[model samples]
Target: MLSEMKDHQSLMAALSENVLIVRMLLSVIFLPGASAGCGAITPVLFSTTPNFMEGLSGSCLQIPCSFNSTDPRYDITRPIYGVWLKATTAFNVTPSSVIFNSSKSVNIYQLEMIGNLTEKNCTTLFSDLNTSYTDRYFFRIESGPVRATACADPLQITVKDSPWSPSINISGGDLKEHQSVTITCSALTPCPHSPPELTWNLQQDSHRQTEKNTDGTFTTKIQENITLSDTHDGYIRCSARYPVNGGNKTAETAVTLSVSYAPRNTSASISPSGLVSAGSWVELNCSSRAKPPASFTWFWNSKHGTINVSVGQVYSFNVTEGGEFYCLATNDLGHQTSSVIRVSIKDNQVSGFTVHIILKILGIIMLYSTIILLECWFRFFKKPKMKTQEPTYVNSEMAKES
Candidate 1:
């Protein structure tokens, strides 16, 4: 019993030394494996590999991988078999999802296992990539006491169709109505075998083109010359289409077009009438047609020329005394002056047919008052005098005749 305990202690000491050596090697290279029994290190180990890979769905992709192991025997004659697999969970240390068994299965992809067991290089490649290739692929190996399902760092393969969306760029910063602008739309075609074609939903005609990059990708573009108007101020979309197996896949991008323009057909008007009256409020409104709503500036013309009085779309003032009023409409693009409108102020707060009615009513009241005065004089002093005077004249005539 004592001899067995001594042997076990020696074995533990040797494993401790191996663990320390492996921990040191971790700085330069990744040595991943399990302890062989209680006294030995893992004979087979998986080396470092990429964690992510992206590929076109209809194209081919290659993942460079390699592995290493600690063999005490240093026996190169013994066959070291390797296998590749995919993992369901990224956090799993060992996975059973099998993809290619290098020992038994036929190597359809030539580079599926370019790494020789003797050389310890385990690079892999896949042909005719599709959605099925989208997974985290891992590496496994079989040797002496080292048997692992998923021993290497898995590679996350991303298989996709064409690019997601296109980008549209407008050359002019502030565009105006009737002005022309250049619109360029671009998209990337990952699968060079069938490059995407660019197109636009423009009111005017446009030109489309495609460029092949040295990285085996294609960039599609379109140049559009648009004559902007009020009707063209809205959302515009650009689309790119790439050929697939059965049909073509399309992607779109939308952008807003804001065409700034100077004001047009600007005019000023008064609320009540062009002729104003004293103490009455007169409202002035300035209006125009513009991309962005126009701002109005009220100006009063005098001997010294036009002078700014107010700023807004609407202005109100007491018609204490009036001369002439006008407004100018303006925006980021340009400005426009409205036609002058003359406002004549009367002495009293009366205007239109209202003045005629008031004057007629006053005239009628004066006429009635004059008639009453005359009637009072006839019924009082004047009537008495006439009756008395006529009697006196008759008596005088009779006295003369006797």
Candidate 2:
């Protein structure tokens, strides 16, 4: 009887063990929350773009998000709902913590779940966001028997009062005159549905486009192909205007262009402009507008055609003769010739005065000599007759007195 009782106890113990094992297997198969020993529940995983994002105070923001679960109980075929919680990881839905809920017809904020919930896309758009909306947010997925929160990763958003400045880029070598280049201005587009308006100060045939970045962000760009000139050597500005709640926010960036070109407006001038005296010092100046200070070559249009006279910005020499003079300005890019200037050279004033004095003295001596010769001829011819006339006048006066 004792052996039989021991056998019955052993059978009872074995049956108890079998029951526990069956219970564990059933739990693993039916219950999604079942732990190890039979099966382990897989955690829900989340994939999101740009862990951090920036938003304008009165504008909107779009978050690119997707999620998946390795557990078989998390069915994607069933109807799914998404929830966004601010500053809290607890899955418990509350009026204060729940900023967005797909099931609710009306929520706390202006939000929309644009992504398809059945496809596991949790992308959401939050509109009329201000500084208050800047916080860490958590995503939750609820589908049938599965309810999971992506607590391992969260998105941190920063909202600012002003919009971000646009960026400017230039391609195809340094800016040079007559060289073709592409200039692009790009602005960040956090929400593709409401992209910022991009504009630039340059007036050219431009192309505008909105493109998606690899990091899931969108950018609106305006580009133009330009052939550089000296006139383009100034500041170029690009501005981005975003539509906000009350008004519009604007931000701008500027870049100064230093375009290298040859020489322009080349000209030559002479100092003491009127008539250049012979044997006197005269200066010929060459001037031009150039990127790199241009080198000058002075030329003289003599009887031998154009001849190189000197090489420098300023040329000084003793004026020997008069002729048409010009200058050539040259740089790495090209060369330009200035308009011809006529240089008039005259005899020195001092020498000319000396010659005039000598001529006057000669004229005076010749006149004096001619007067002496005439007086001598008059004396030789009429002296006797003059004495006789005086005597007759004296006799006539005496006779009248008598």
Candidate 3:
């Protein structure tokens, strides 16, 4: 054991170049009544308080830690310096991860250790925490030969991002029209004395309730039982307000309400409603506004038991004579047939054909006018030119001599 102590001292000396390790040795060397060989003292059995805790990002975190030893060789109430280290694993402890060494390096956190080593409390405060700070943390004591560390089962800490809205709990099912349902919204209050106020924006009759927990925290719950109707099938919101510096901070949550019902407001229409001809194109359309869009079925009225033409929103085909056409819209709840629309198929040349024939005659007249213009241009304005005779020079004088 004496040789082992010498080897430990040599290893400590070799690592003295690191400021953290040097500070750790100084913390141990400055302990009260630690004036003896380093190896003569016994190690301590250390354990932390509240083996696990949760922290929120973008906020300050406090870990209340305390430890004591089972070994009778040490006194539990004495002022023994400590070294706090953070590690990924508790089995293999290393010296490079030392966070702080009391009596030498202070102010490693936002505030100095709020714990008293003489009282066996090693609580620490970390400020402006972020997601990357999730890990296991433990403490170590290095006074004389009593150099000890606790990492086998260090404290587990998980960090979460700040929540945007309050938690909303709803209890109901199978929401039909005119149904009643209960909804509750809750928000956490860090202060017990001042509970937050809750309100629902849907203008429903709601009640507010608050509870005080044993951990000095408060919870505000707002509940409402409302008869849901067509007007209630929109965004329903709940908000919680808490007092701040001079005003208030509020958080809200919203949910869309969907109500199921049968098909309603059914109607049918023909594309060409006024006039039609035999073997002319026409379309019949059926529509309804329903929760789960209703199915459509088209029918053409005839003496032979109303022939079922098709099953869809639109039916298009050529019609022979004037007939009756309608459609049926059905859903899970109920079904309804639209009012019959009488289609008039003109067998004796409808007035629409006269307009079409007039348009055709106008087109033929324009074509003939264009042909006449071209022929007149060729006969008069576009006539071929005749060849000109060459002029005779001094022919008059030659004629007089002959």
Candidate 4:
């Protein structure tokens, strides 16, 4: 009888202990706000990027957001609806408090929940946003028994009357002649569905694309490939046009391009152009078009070949012999030679009239000498015998007549 009583007591104690353990497990699994192992429940948290957002009054704005809850009962795979409340953190579903609701066909505000709520993506878009929409906003999620508001991580918004200016970027070192570079014009695209139109002053064919940034924003970009030249040294402008409800808003930005290139159109000119007398001084000037000012070197084409003369923009020298002269323009980029020019030189001691007078005097002297020689030959050599015979008959007749 004693053994039987001891075994029954031991079985009753064991059954009581197992019943207590079963009760604890049932409370953990069925009780509201109770976690497994009877641990503390985890609070829902929200994560968002760029807590502050600035937008154009006539344009649109995008809010990138995500949320999570550590409670195992929260099932995201169920039908999830996202809500955006303006100026209030209270979990209210009223029309005045809620600006957007993914479950509703239309909301009080022109807002859309573009993100996949089931995937915990709560990114929202607000179109035709004005200054009245500038306020703090909160996000809320509802799925089955999970209903929570991410009020701790509110998004602040500010709207302005003017639009944001576009930016220009040049890649591939410094701008230089004959070198290809990529010029990118980027404009902020808060609403990816209606990206801003981008236009630039560069005439090259460009490639256009819209990309998402790490900050959860979108940007519309146009890239152009250009081979630089001296003519590219000017201001390049890029403009962004946003299509709003009333009209299009525009903003522009400009960047100056300074291109480095070799000298071009190099030429040398003489100050006193025409004929130059020997032993007279004349000035030669060299000029060229270059990004950095070019250094000038005068060169003379002699019988032996091209020889370097003086080094300067202007060179003055006494004219002794006629020859071809040119100039060489050089810079860090490259060099160029000017066309050859001829410099004429004449004797300074003798004038043109003096040589003409000397030649005329010599011709007159030769003619007079020839006339004297002819008379002398006639008087001294041929007439001595012939004159005697002719004169005898003539003299006799003349004496009789007398």
Assess each prediction's global lDDT (C-alpha) against the native.
0.70, 0.83, 0.70, 0.81
Residue-wise C-alpha lDDT for candidate 2, range 99-189, written one tens digit per residue: 7789984478788998888877778888888888888787877789877766656678888898999999989878899999988999998
Q: How do the predictions measure up, each by TM-score?
A: 0.48, 0.73, 0.45, 0.70
RMSD of 3: 20.7
lDDT of 1 by residue, 77-184 (tens): 667667776665434434346667678664433335656767776666566677776877767766655555444355687888664688999987677787888888
Candidate 4 residue-wise lDDT, 187-305, digit = tens: 98876777888888887456668899988888999988889999888899999998887888899999999999999999999969977898899999999999898999999989889
Worst 10 residues of 2 by lDDT: 33-42
Poorly placed runs, candidate 2 (over 4 Å): 1-42, 88-95, 348-402
- Compute the lDDT for candidate 2: 0.83
**Scored by Cα lDDT, where does model 1 land?**
0.70
* Backbone clashes (count) for model 2: 0
Q: Candidate 4, overall lDDT?
A: 0.81
Which rank order by lDDT, best down to worst? 2, 4, 1, 3
Candidate 2, residue 332: CA error in Å? Answer: 1.1
For model 3, residues 118-196, the per-residue Cα lDDT tens digits are 7777766666556777777777776555667664337676665643366777678887666788767887644323456
